[model samples]
Target: MELTVSPAPHIHDNLTVSKCMYNVIIALLPAFAVSLYFFGIGALIVTLSSILSCVIVEYLIQKYLLKEKPSIGNGSAILTGLLLAFNLPSNLPIWIVVIGSIVAIGIAKMSFGGLGNNLFNPALAGRVFLLISFPTQMTQWPRPIVSRWNYTDTETGATLLSKLKEEGSQWIEQIDIANLWIGNQGGSLGEVGAIALLIGFAYLLYRKIISWHIPVSILLTVFLFSFVLACGQETGNMQNIPMWQYAFDFALIQLLSGGLLLGAIYMATDYVTSPMTSKGMIIYGIGIGILTVVIRQWGGYPEGVSFAILIMNAFTPLINNYIKPKRFGNHRS
Candidate 1:
């Protein structure tokens, strides 16, 4: 009889690298369906192009550049591509989508030794690169429903966040919260679908793919911070609405609008870039929430989730160092 000894993780379940990645993909499907319904052909084109480009780029980089076996079968590249596409305007040109994919796989991912080692979320890195390189195209969000059949030629409109940033509280009453929740507005493919994103979040939780620490902490921080700000401001057009009501509505908008939900639930929860410990995750999420609000309120850009996640990603190592879980089998004196 032969006995084999392994390190910690001796008791294992059916989970694998591929399984986790695919689970995330499955979770993202509801959001993708909402995007297709709202953005139509443009969403499909952008998504396909991004996914194909990411897989191809990673395959080629591994096979030729790194002289290693391609790992696209693990589904990391596909997830990266899907997330990148989610961060982008659906009407963005295919060439630009390809460029972002290449950056995502070739630089942010492959250059960092391919998944599980990257410093930043590959999708956010690629999206930020594109946002800087092609600000005009990236910001021109196609209007939902009306742009169904259109691609790059779709009619464009400002997102709710952008409107709020530009016009302040005056335009608050005009926003149709119901329509926004159901994704009948202008924004990135994933950003508009609040309900779909929440559904996906629930699925991820049900599958135990992610813990509640990161997502819940982020939402709480953003809500409380935004609520404080909302209550302090004098909008002057309250129109008989109670101040608390205005504050609550504004906080709700912060939760539903732009990429807050998607980023909080998906991107900030990336295993490689996020802290390992639950306490560390909460700290990381809090940092992301604060930075997101700061950038949206004062920074040049209207959206801040991508930037917030990436910035927190850079600090994950530090958070892990300081906030580690107790070592297994170790007892107190």
Candidate 2:
């Protein structure tokens, strides 16, 4: 074979879109397994139905509607399906999962020109849509393990965020940190557990699938803000806590509980929806963290990670516009 000489150095990445998607799927498996172990058949049904519905919708839209090569085999739709299910209650009806799948893949994704061109994170958008449309069903959190086998009739209860918002620091006195960390509380299928989300986060970090900018900034900002609010007596966020230890404990609980871990680690770091540069990513992360705390503390909802991420997603374009990446071969200023 004759050699065709070009540049002095040659480097092969060998990483394709499919490879990246599969890596993300692997990272997400820990959370999926945790949900399955906690919710049993309900988790299985919701996940499978959502995945199938998303794949089917994407297939039909690409093959018949969009008249493009079917990209369902790339696993984006399946990932979206899994993520949307993760954000929802395990006891939700199958029809609702289907609707969420449609909204995620069809509206939030394809409507904005698919995959790399979408505006918001499709799964988060679908989740917010469901939460708004079906408030009661969306907030119905089934107690974990206790309702492992049960689906619709599972024993349901409120999340830590709800307790913190309504009953204040009383949630700390009632529920210990161990239960919250290990995810024994009631909430969405995947969002309930901190351990599982951490595992996935570690895997993603190991595989270089995601960077630490967005997640770390978001988590740190949340900690600092909550610490200030807890220690400060302006609006009395953490009342009845005289000691500093108790105040820090409440802030820790707020960090580990709810969808903060899930959204910060996975949803907010979405490749197409998030900012490009490191500075932009930090700004975006800070915005999400602040918005999340604001919504949880004073906004109408107790859990605000989804809404926070979506709102930040809308600002991504502006962030990119101002904080742009350095040019390849151009020197200016």
Candidate 3:
């Protein structure tokens, strides 16, 4: 009888890419619902347009360019679309959202071999591209829902950073932390509501779609760093620093403002782009937190989470290399 050999058995994990992406989309629903509630139908319009555009583009690209069966069914494209939309302003034109989706799916994702192969987060890259390409539109924040909407008028309102940059420490004293937390303040549509983002985060945690290491570390790092900064200003013998009255103002402004929550919980934890090891995740989170604070405090941008996340994404490989988990009974040479 001839010897018979067979290929090794293939093991499958229960968590498919589609399942992971779908869970993420489901997790984002609370934030989306809250955004629609606060920002009107405009947010919904941008989100839907982005999702449709991304899925269609992905299908076409896979069919024609790659000559492979389309993976849009996997829900990665939809996730990218939602993330790109979330990064945008509610008042941005539909055409801008289309362009953002094209950049995200076509250039950032497909060009790099799609999904798991891309080095940088496609949504962040697209957002950054739009920021550079359309500074006026990207930076021109809409007034909170309380303000009347006028389609023709694109009057500029100050972001938290813009206010700080223009008015210094005095500007923060005038802000309402409650409004900021509850999504009644002026910022990007999805980023406005801290409560909504946290609710979504809790859902993700409950579902186990993401581990708690990255989000918790990033938030803690930012909180601790900002706290120390506030304390230093209060009693560190720096005569030039603002009065102690402004310390809590500074910390709260840093905590409950801009894209910090969204980026910390959602973007930074991207499964493929982030590291695999727990230690690496912690390091990545701390790196992003420190960079975010540094950029917000001293860099030109008022909000720094996007840049911080992208920068940390670039270092994921190095982090993984150094922070590998030890194998069972393995000894280091």
Candidate 4:
């Protein structure tokens, strides 16, 4: 037999795209279930429509548009659909869900040469696109406990974080930490439930689907920075409350009340979009965390997670370029 020489990374593992993507889908189920339990028919309709739209779009693009083999079998389209739906209002019109799915798979994913080649997270790009174009429908969040069966005609309400933005720290009186944790607040399809998102985060960590670097970095940065901001202020609500307690509550609200957990755990850590090295991931995460707090506190929007992630996604290439592993026999440091 002839001898052959190949480049390094000579070892092969049993991992497949199918297994990895399916595991992610599995990990997302806890949050998805919470959305169903709270939003019911609305959630189901949006999810199915988004998934179907994404799958069909990818198939057609590969078959006819690109004249290449279909890649939807890898479940990237399905995953994109689920994530897009997660980032959207559950009561959004079915046609809008279709539009978002098309944008996710067509423009964000396929247009960039498919899965591993995309520069931005497809779901979030789709979300930002929808948010900018249809701000009214996208921002209308249906409150929980209204009805499981109600999809469209349900009463719309502002989220706690929005109230915080409008009414200042005083709105904290209206928000119960327990209700927010249990997913009874008004928000997007999957982002309202802190407990469910945490459960999903735990599963992803346990499965080794993602490392702790990105998520931990983003969360810790948000907490520490927000604690500093809280300590500098003297809101009346915190007068009687201990300083530490008030700061903790303020940071916790920043953490739990929006898509921070969702973005930190799932969206920001996307394999193709995030940094390749631990150091680079940390930098990426820190940027996301700081930008999120800045936007939440000063920017016009009440929530800044999706925008923050997309913005950081733009820097991922620069991060990877500057922070790379040492060469095999050319270590300079």
The candidate that achieves the highest lDDT relative to the unseen native structure: 1
lDDT of 3 by residue, 1-333 (tens): 898787854555688888889988888888888777766666777789889999999999999999999989999999999999899887789899899999999998999998888888998999999998999889877676644344325444778767876666556656788887788766776687788888889988988889999998888888878767766643434355555556756766787788888888888999988999998999999999999989987888888899999999999999998899997598974
Q: Summarize candidate 4's per-residue lDDT along 1-333 as a digit string, tens digits.
A: 999899976887876888778888998898899989898899999999999999999999999989999988898889999999999888899999999988888999889998899999999999999999999999999877685688888888888788988887776656689977988888888787888888888888898889999999999999999999988866775577787877888898899888999899989989999999999999999999999999999999999999999999999999999999887799578
* Candidate 4 off by > 4 Å: 1-3, 7-9, 329-333
Off by over 4 Å in 2: 1-12, 233-242, 328-333
Q: Which candidate is the best by TM-score?
A: 1
TM-score, one value per model: 0.97, 0.92, 0.90, 0.96
The TM-score obtained by model 1 is 0.97
Please say which candidate is ahead in TM-score: 3 or 4. Answer: 4
- Candidate 2 overall lDDT versus native: 0.88
Point out the higher-scoring one by TM-score: 2 or 4: 4
lDDT of each model, Cα atoms only?
0.92, 0.88, 0.83, 0.89
Residue 198's lDDT in candidate 3:
88
Query: Quick one: ranking by TM-score, best first?
Result: 1, 4, 2, 3
* Pairs with steric clashes in candidate 2: none
* 254: Cα error in model 1, Å: 0.4
